[model samples]
Target: MTILAIGAAGIAAVLLAVWLKGVRAEYAVYLVMAAEILFMLSAAGRLEVILDAMERMRGYIRVDSAYLGTLLKMIGITYVAEFASGICRDAGYGALGNQIQILGKLSVLGVSMPVFLALFETLERFMK
Candidate 1:
């Protein structure tokens, strides 16, 4: 979907949720969750295009496929963590959301460790 359509949908969802919050607060939360699912589904449809572009860039750049894969994984982790954390916070679980963000950061760090090691090794070689 185009950004304009997505923005419209998001605004509509928020407005409806706000109205619903006055009547049934729990339903408002459900509405938000449903909207999030819809938005995520819409975004998933574009992932292939993004992956194809990344692949093209990799072809031109001579970078390791493993590193590209790691970068993609890190991006995925960050998005999923942020998505989950936002939902948690919306549901009134701020602490859980914070923990999710922390875990996401740590997971990204862990996933990129190999790249860090390679960089350090390169630096060490230059130092010799």
Candidate 2:
């Protein structure tokens, strides 16, 4: 999993460099999405491991469940945004892709409100 992730990052970095060197933005986006897909697929079969790692990190970081939940929500938001944006781009509506991205961000923020409120309530109780 780590290896796949590292390779994906390396490829993305190279693709980004290619774009910076004037290699066409469209190709760069394709390459980035391909890399993301590859890494995501590699991680797909290891969800248990991923969750365990997240839990271990939570323990090490001394973070509450709210923080972990928010992190997960952000991750989900990123995945959905990328998917919708890609679809819109494939359909030849770059403008729609941008709109989808904005909508995704808003939806994630809205969904996270409950968790944030719960966290705030916990903190308030602690303060009292």
Candidate 3:
């Protein structure tokens, strides 16, 4: 979906949620979650294109496939964590949201450990 369309939909959802908050507060949270799911679904289509572009770049750069795969996993973890955390915060669980974010950071760090090790190895070789 185009940015304009997405923006319009987001604004509409927010307005509706604000109105629903007055009538049925719980339903407003549900509505917001539904809107977030729809938005994520729409963005999923574009994610394929991004992945394809990254693959082509990897081929041109001759980088190890494992590194590229790790990068993708890190990116995925970051986005998913942010999405989940946002939902939690919206549902009035700010602490849960913060924890989700921290977990995401740790996950990303864990996933990138191999890359960090490889870099250190390369640097050590140069120093030798």
Candidate 4:
């Protein structure tokens, strides 16, 4: 959380500086690039903690196994899609952003295919 806080503070400082100096919003894209770099550098370490938190939440709530994996996958898909989309947008490539979004959606569906199949089988069994 400290890294996140620091990054947020740095972004706020950059925006404030830009505003004070009459920098164009386009110039602020550099700050977004810097933040994306920081996220890329820090994400591996952060992912472990995030998974741990998810595990803890699952245990604390005793969530149904069928729901838990789906939720986790949804969260992962959202985060990855948002991160890719944001970076592409920040780089001023709307076409690339749209492509990234399409890829994200396709990748997510690919990853979720097995889970969906399992759920379908389970439903089939229940109906029989």
TM of each candidate vs. truth? 0.95, 0.52, 0.97, 0.62
lDDT by residue for model 3 (26-110), tens = 9999999998999889987788888999889987898998988999999899989999999999999999999999999999999
Query: Residue-wise lDDT of candidate 2 within 1-128, one digit each (tens)?
Result: 58866777866666584765485767765665676566567656676776898899987887878767777777778776877787567546899999989988898888788888988999999999
All candidates' lDDT scores?
0.93, 0.75, 0.94, 0.74
Cα RMSDs, all models: 1.0, 5.9, 0.8, 4.7
Off by over 4 Å in 3: none
Residues 1-128, model 1: lDDT tens digits: 89999899999999999999999999999999898888888987888988998899998989899988998999899989999998998888999999999999999999999999999999999999
Off by more than 4 A, model 2: 1-49, 58-70, 126-128
Which regions in candidate 4 have their CA more than 4 angstroms from the true location? Answer: 2-28, 40-44, 53-78
- Residue 80 lDDT, candidate 1, scale 0-100: 93
Q: What is the lDDT of candidate 1?
A: 0.93
Model 4, range 1-128, lDDT digits (tens) per residue?
48778678667856764684465675677666676766665665577777788789887897666666776786678677878887887667888888888887887788778788878998999999
Q: What's the CA error at residue 82 for candidate 2, in Å?
A: 1.5
How many clashes (backbone atoms < 3 Å, residues ≥3 apart in a chain or on different chains) does model 1 have? 0
For residue 59, give model 4's deviation from the true position in Å. Answer: 7.0
Count of clashes, each model: 0, 0, 0, 0
